[model samples]
Target: MKPELLPLLTCPSCRDGDLTLEAQEEDALGVKTGRLACPTCRTVFPIADYVPSFLPEESGGERWREAWSYKWENVAEQVRYSPEGDEDFERKLNFGNHFSGDFRGKWVLDAGCGSGQDAARMASRGATVVGVDQSRGVYLAQRYNQDTPHADRLHFVRADLFHLPFRPEIFDAIYSNGVLHHTPDTRRAFDAIAPLLKRGGLIGVWVYDRTQYWRLFETFWRPVLSRLPRPALSAFLHAVNRPWHWIYRYRTLMMDKVNPWPESSVARHLADLFSGGQLLYLLTDYHLHLAHRVEDPFIRHHHAFDAYSPTFAWGHDESELFEWFKAQKISVTAISPVRTGLIGVKD
Candidate 1:
């Protein structure tokens, strides 16, 4: 962590002020190794590889932390050696489009930054982004972005969303995409980060929407899948992806007939058979909406793992989320055309 970031960090445990840094190694670049000490609370947070660790010993959400940490560690080499080029950049642009103000020269907080991809993108756009994640993905993110032009502007910290190690109203903007829902309580996660944005500062978030079809699937299958051992679950997902890919590859032939739900019993039985009768309802429902857009086998499997691996993956209702923002005294700025992305300004 850099010496400049010391002022922005507060004791997440005690919410105390005047955090003192004990720099074990310092140079022209920054504090290479150090510990942030909170005198009032007597808490010490270690700085490892220029990233501060603020996660508590008994941090809740252990399932997600373990799953993402393992996932990123395995993919770190792939991400660093051969980064996703245009496809990645396009996704970042789509994410940034939800925000209200320009990011240039802004102090942005990327809450739940996975592998630091979006953080690096925002930093490349001239935002000084502080990316925080509770998992070991922070290390992967740091390594992945180490060679970028905006590497100095991007900071990684291992911190939990419920207890971030930053003072209130310190950030000019906050962007959290496809993250909050994975936490045990999405609303609480939002509430925790909402206070960090400066008054009038914008915040953008994209979360899974609780569509009726998605709700039905999640209600029935998510509970069982979430509890499965990692190896078994991964194996199951790999097997599931085979059929998913097959369906996508031949979607042209089968999609039109099944795209519109069958009105007759015979067609319904045929649709069920075509879906392999394994997760019949869920697979058919998902393929109907997304099979045409399925590209990149790696990303398809990655997203499949991401969807079912997390212990808590709650989808939100648009109106309910907007009401929550209103209750927090934040003015709604824009809701994305898809209705999953929401942007609001702190009042």
Candidate 2:
């Protein structure tokens, strides 16, 4: 780790100045080249290759090992389907006034870094980022980030949210976009990562916006869809949604008549080309959709045990969220109502 960066660090556990960095050797997994010890807490954390391991235990253990396996299984496809086009960028811009200034040398933690897409974005902006994900998402992240200009600064690990293996108070900023909600206990997940932040560190989170549109789908429709086998449901979606794709691909008058876009001819033509109704449906099954270990018989279940476990899928109202944050006593610096983006700073 850079010597200049050391002064900005503090003990993640004690949140005091009693911690000191010890020169330690890198382990087999290239973790914790040094140690950060908190005399107050008697807690020692390892820093691997300059990236601290805040996890309480190993990344791939009992509770979250399956998540890593799932990430490894589907990361390539997930990255491809993630928002990558002009529309996606627009969506991210809509999220809050995050990163209005340069982040050229900031140390950032991308919590729940699914497939490392957001991590890649932060790195592109010149941030030295460490992306942590429970799933084997780190594998794909490492693969995608290896050749970049900031590769030396970018790192990843398969880790749990509850027991992060990182030194406390080391990160300048931490962000988790659309991730905390997916955990078994969202509040616990939030509590786990929040303690690791430095006093002045920024914490930005983009959770699933509680909307009627999402509710209609996630609550009523998704449960119904989750009942079927994966292959059968996927095939059914592909078949039924074929017409939408056909109309989209062909731009025929009849097809447009059935699935209307807008009154204007040009608008109709454009919608047919770009509208993502069918593709969205297919993605619902494979990506956003979840099964209670029905798809994979092996490994432990994370979300659903009875095939209908509620888990942490609960959505919060804006007022409820604000009150929760108030209870935490964190200062809200910026709020973006458009994307339901909430950005805060720890005092």
Cα RMSD, each candidate: 4.1, 8.3
Q: Global CA lDDT of candidate 2, please? A: 0.56
The candidate scoring highest on lDDT is 1
The ten-residue window of minimal lDDT in model 1 covers 280-289
Error of 2 at 103 (Å): 1.7
Q: Give per-residue lDDT, candidate 2, residue 87.
A: 33
Q: Kindly list the per-residue Cα lDDT of model 1 for residues 1-347, writing each as its tens digit.
A: 77767778899999978789888987644676889999998999998877889888886567778887866665333434324433433343254565434678789999998788778877877889999998898988877777778887888999999989999999999878778888889999999999999998988777777883455665677788778876776677667676666664565456556567653456664675466533542432243344336455555555556666678878877887898788778898777654466788899
Instruction: Give each model's clash number.
Output: 1, 16
Question: How many angstroms is residue 221 displaced in model 2 relative to the true structure, after the best TM-score fit?
Answer: 3.9
Best by TM-score: 1
